[model samples]
Target: MLAKTPFIPDKPILIVCGHFGSGKTCVSVALALALKKSGKNVTLVDLDIVNPYFRAADAAELMKANGINCINPEFANTNVDIPSLGAEIHSVFVNAERDPDSVTILDVGGDSGAAALGRYRQMIERAGYNMLFVASKYRPLTDTASAALENLREIEYYSRLRCTHVVNNSNIGDETTQTYVENALDFGRELSELSGLPEAFTSVVKADFCPALAEKYPDKSFFFIDNTTRKLF
Candidate 1:
C-alpha cells in the first residue's frame, strides 16, 4: 500500500514535470495508483517526448491490470522518434469533467520535454490544472535549490502552467535507503523554501528498504511506488 502522502495533488487534473532523470515517471505511476486506491477512476498520460527510457508507457500493462487508463506517444515502446500523442490524450479531460469523480494524471516529459506539451496548453489551461514539478537533488541542474527553481521556471514557461508544488523524488536508483529518504526530506524543505512552493512530499520506492523509514516518519507525507520503471544509471 502507498503512503497517505500530502503531496498527492487533489485536483481532478494534474501534470508531473521534472528535469531529465529526476524520476518523474516513477512518481507519475505511483500517483495514478494512489488516486485509484483512493476510489477515483484515474487516467495517466505519458507525454515523455524527451527520454524514451523510464517512461509511463512502460507501465501500461500493469496500469491496465489495475484499472487505470494510460496514454502515451503514438510511437511509444518503439524505436521511432515520432513525438505525436494519440487523440485519447484529450479525452482524459473530457471524461474527467463528464465523470466528476475521475482524476487525470499527466506525466509530462522532462525539462526539454516540456516543449512537446506546449501544443496542448489551451486545452489544459482553459480547463485549469496544476503541474507538479518533481525535483531530485541527485540530478544535474537540480542539485541545489537555485538550480531547482531555474529548471522549474523553464518547465513552467514551456508548459504554460505554473507549478503549485514540488515533489522531492531524489533517489539513487536501486541503492536507495532509509538514510537517503531522510536526507531527501531536508532537500525537499530547502527547495520548498527557495521556490516558494510547498514541498509536496518525498517519493520513495516501496521496496524492501523503505518500510522502516516510512513507518518512522509518520508526520512527513510520502508517495511510495514500485521503482521498476526507473532508469537506473
Candidate 2:
C-alpha cells in the first residue's frame, strides 16, 4: 500500500505546468491518487493540447480505475477527426469552481505549449486557481530555472495567475538514491531562494525509501506517493 501524505489542499484548483519531460503527467496522476486516498474528490483535467506524448488523457483508464474523475477530449472514431472531439472538456474550470468539495488538477502542456494557457486565462482567473511549475535540475543545465521562470512569466501573462510554487522533480531513473534526493532538495532550495520564489513547494522522490528518508530530513517537509514523493508548503 502507498503511504498517504496530507500535503495536498482540500479543494483548490491546481495547475501543474512544466517543460516537456519534466514529469508533469506523472506528478499530476500521483497527486490525484494521493488526494483520492485521503478522501478528497479529485478530478484531473488534461489541457496538454500541444504534446501528443505523455499526455494525462492517455492515462484516463488508469485514473478511472482508481475512482478518480478525468476530463479530456474524447476520441469517438477510429480515424481521429478534430471535429469529433467533444466540447465538455472546455468547461472544466467553470464546473470545478461550482463544486467546493472537489479538487481539480489541470495538467497543462509545457514550453511551446505555453500558448495553451492563454486560451483558458479567463476561466482560471475567474476560478482563482493556484499554479505550480515543475522543475528538474538533473534533466537540463542549471539555467533551466531561468528559462522555466521566463516561460512561467509568459504563462502568467496569459493565465492571469502567478505561479506560486515550484516542484523539483529531479531523478536518475532507478539509480535514484537517498543522497540524490537530498541533493535535489538542496538544489531546489537554492534555486527557490535565488529566484525569490517561496522555498521549492516540494521535491519529488521515489517512494521505496521515502518514509525513512522523510524521517531523516524532518526539517524539509514531504508528501509521499506511489513510486514518488514531494515536499510542499
Against the true structure, what is every candidate's RMSD? 2.1, 5.0
**Least well predicted 10-residue stretch by lDDT in candidate 2:** 224-233
Show where candidate 2 strays beyond 4 Å: 75-86, 141-148, 157-160, 199-205, 225-233
Residue pair clashes in candidate 1: none
Off by over 4 Å in 1: 5-8, 206-211, 214-216, 230-233
Tens-place lDDT digits, model 1, residues 1-233: 66553444556788889898888888888878877877888898988887766689999988999999888889987977788888888897788568877778888888878987788888777666777889998886788878988999999888777899888888887787778777767788888898898877778765565667657887767767678574545
lDDT of each: 0.80, 0.67
For model 2, what is the alpha-carbon lDDT of residue 207?
67
lDDT value, residue 54 of candidate 1: 66
